[model samples]
Target: MTSPTLALDPAWITRTVAVALDEDLGPAPGRDVTTQSTIPADAVGAADLVARQDGVVAGLVVAPEVVGQVAARLGLAVPSVDQRVADGTRVARGDVLAVLTGPVQVLLVAERTLLNLASRASGVATHTRRWADALEGTGALVLDTRKTTPGLRALEKYAVRCGGGTNKRMGLYDVAMVKDNHVVAAGSVAAAIEAVRTRFPDVTIQVEADTLDQALEAVGAGARFLLLDNMPTPLLAEVVAAVRAVDPRVELEATGNLTLDRAREVASTGVDYLSVGGLTHSSPILDLALDLEPLQPV
Candidate 1:
């Protein structure tokens, strides 16, 4: 099988992992009191991160980083993590996602941190996969919104990509999105689009439209991307057709109250994307656990 490639920044992984470890173990010179009290200093063991349910795997690469940071805090030898599966790969229940070997205390200390990141990422990926599957062959892709957990945006967005969903924008900086408020402030959709285009000429501007007139006005004002907010299928199709006629290159996305049951119907309207906030905001964690086993010192 081909190795799955995950394009997460090393620094982002390191920084996020450090923060998560701090949360669990507390500030510098932190300790997992329970593990420190029970496990012997010289004791060494191994464990396998096992999947408790079938789902797409993600964040395995960050496991070793978590182990390393945990070991540093506890002054224990860092564990060697053998990743059995790559990120984005589908796995069944009971699959061994990775193996860890080191001081028993280190394993115990890092267990929750490892499972938390992996499980959450896998959950988003699994949830996104459903949308992707539903919209397959509809000439539309599932897109993730900015409605992600703060500080976890990069990781969660990466998980979205793993599950075959596209990310809309990294944040407010990359894309200038003129929502209803912006339209109200600037007087109209055209005015809002023009203001953003004038101020940030280099950045791509997307306008949110609640009506066909607004959608057309956005395109006329030079917006190549339009966000159709909460429109029913017929009206959504109308906007799509109108936008295409104006500029076939003007990409359209149908957003709000989207569900798997209606994914195909919405995509069938010829919108370029279906942006779902639930992919990150409401996905449940995929169940995973670290099963520890005693091992002889190598």
Candidate 2:
């Protein structure tokens, strides 16, 4: 069953799965030569996608798409992908997340691609969950940055959501973030804000401020959101208090050099969010493997 919370678009999944299949099986008419050589044309098999380590599951919804795409490329009937666990479900080691039944060749062809997506996504979710768990009850939400896999931003950001973290900005088009470079280019924080507002007035603007003066200047210049980059806990608390006094509605996010051990202390500073780039960049893949049972003669 699909997890209602995971809003993975069907078209995105199809396109991504197709690209992944091409990467593995090569161009059209290209195939898994090993499977073709060893497996009988009509042989069938069953397999389980088992977790080798505990983690929050993700990307199960994309499994069927992967199977179908691989079958299409291999000129075989589409496989039956029975997903046993929904995305976002916490899974223990040895848990069976899905069962696959189809042509032996199709199963083999889709195995690696499916496992790649599931493992990466689950890893991100697991890492984000740790941050989320750390800041629980602190009235602060964990946020993810653009530090995502080049072609898998949607998948990674969705995994962050599954782990109870909020997505900061999907891309540069969606949000106008004035960082140190943007500030330098425009001459001042206010100038950058004015330029972005004049060009893309509807886009949400977030200003990255390294000092308390810059933070206050950003708010006075009408920046409703601020990324408090790399500030110490005491200074961050002071900035938060100062901003709140000036404009209580201005949102604040603490970012950079953050560790799980200091998550609560940072969140306790009354910032609205904490941005972590490591959610997608540094997370290790959640161990998973496809255990294919012996092929059965058709």
Candidate 3:
């Protein structure tokens, strides 16, 4: 059976690729001098997108989209992209992920930009997979935070999903989360929850609590979800029992300073979700390279 692939917003891919291509190619007066002078415009070439290091594959579709956009900009035929592996597939070093064939110059032009998207997304997926694997068999789920690269949130979060992690909330618009600052400004957890509930009656409201008192207070304010911030495993377990006693339905999420080493222990505390910021912000780029095959006469 074939693995399912991710679907991205076509318009977002187009806009992002256009900006990336423009940045690399510069303005019309400036050109890729080396390719322009050496490679003939009609010269056809093929290249393989190879993995320099093992990682989970993500954003395979985006690479082709970027190639097609660059081809249109340069008036070259869009390259044929044959993706050998689906997103979420684990690959080893030297694995050929995809094949690209078209004008050599166009291929060179799109090379770096396409690799940037794929490598970055794959990096996030690879890191997230570790967390998912760590929490395997635990009832808790690995979740991604909003701390993602600007203009790449959707793609990054999608990569997390591909890595077996769940997305907590897309943005501030999707969920109402009252944190410590909001509680301070509102004078209490209940007050903050009340204000958000009064303003956005239909949204899911989650309150952040630093202590057991605040957690109980949040539950009293009709918050069905609570974010237990920075608590140790023992305290987290205690809070879980307390909250469950008050209202068994109140969902709890543990956040702050969550490291992969402690993921299983934290999940054992009975929290429903473990939100990790490092999944996107701190993941190293997966090493990938585009190796051009020798040119042949058409």
Candidate 4:
């Protein structure tokens, strides 16, 4: 069943930098003057795409053939996009998942672009999945904050969903999050909530608060959701409990410094959502590679 709260698979935000890279870097050099003068042109080679780190693979479909396009442009027969690579699975270093059979020069030229997309997108997916798994067994769900790459928001958020995370408000207009600065600029939490409510009453107004009093104040002021920012776990528990006692219907979420180790502990507080920025900003890449298999002989 789809969770009533978080939506996933908004795949319209596809990242197609692979085509861009191929367009920029011309077809692989057929005969390198330096290579031919020094080495034989008939020296063909093949290499397997090996994993260098442990991670949940993601974006392999789009990642693999990028180099192939580069190789094809360079006069090499590149592989297909359908070349199979398992995704969302854990892998160790030195595991061969793809084999590229083309001119050694083509492989060498295409190497960087292939690895660049693999590492970067995979990192985002893996981190996002961790948040999804962290809230497992609890009714809570993991959400990715808007703290994403500037132009890559759509693709990055797509990767988050691929990792099983729920994407929060995509932009400022999607949802109304009454943060500290807004509250301060408005001179009060009530004022901040009122401004958003006045303009976009139908929007989901999530107000961030530091103390139980602020949390309650936000609830009393009709915040649809409350974000408890930078509060201690114990204090978070108290605030949640207090909020429940006063207004059980108000949704609560926790943000700020939410590391993986502290995930379950905080989720145990009965907060509805946990927002993490690491999924995009600081996540390590997913390990993946694209290697071509030898074409079958007639």
Model 4 Cα lDDT, one tens digit per residue, 125-195: 77877778877998888888878877566656766776777778889887888888898899999998888
Clashes by residue pair, model 2: none
User: What are the Cα lDDT values of the candidates?
Assistant: 0.89, 0.90, 0.88, 0.70
Per-model TM against the reference: 0.96, 0.97, 0.95, 0.75
When 3 and 4 are scored with lDDT, the better candidate is 3
Model 2 lDDT, residue 258, Cα: 95
Looking at model 2, residue 90 earns an lDDT score of: 90
Candidate 3 accuracy as TM-score: 0.95
lDDT of 3 by residue, 1-298 (tens): 0112446778888888877877888853236778888999899989999999998988887988877877777787888998899888899999999999888888898888889999999999999999999999999888888899998987898899888888888899979999988878999888888888789998899889989998998899898999999999999999999999999999999999899899999999899989999999999989999999998766
Residue 207 displacement in candidate 3 (angstroms): 0.8
Which candidate leads the pack in TM-score? 2
Kindly list the per-residue Cα lDDT of model 1 for residues 1-298, writing each as its tens digit.
0112447888998999888888887886687788899888879989999999999988787987888888888888899999999888899999999989988998998899889999999999999998998998899999998899999998899999899888888898988999999888999888887788788888888888999998988888888889999999999999999899889999899999888999999998999889999999999999999999866755
| Ranked by TM-score, top first | 2, 1, 3, 4
Count the clashes in each prediction.
Answer: 0, 0, 0, 11
Most accurate candidate by lDDT: 2
Query: 1 or 4, which is superior by lDDT?
Result: 1
Worst 10 residues of 2 by lDDT: 1-10
Off by over 4 Å in 2: 1-6
Regions of model 3 farther than 4 Å from truth: 1-6, 27-30
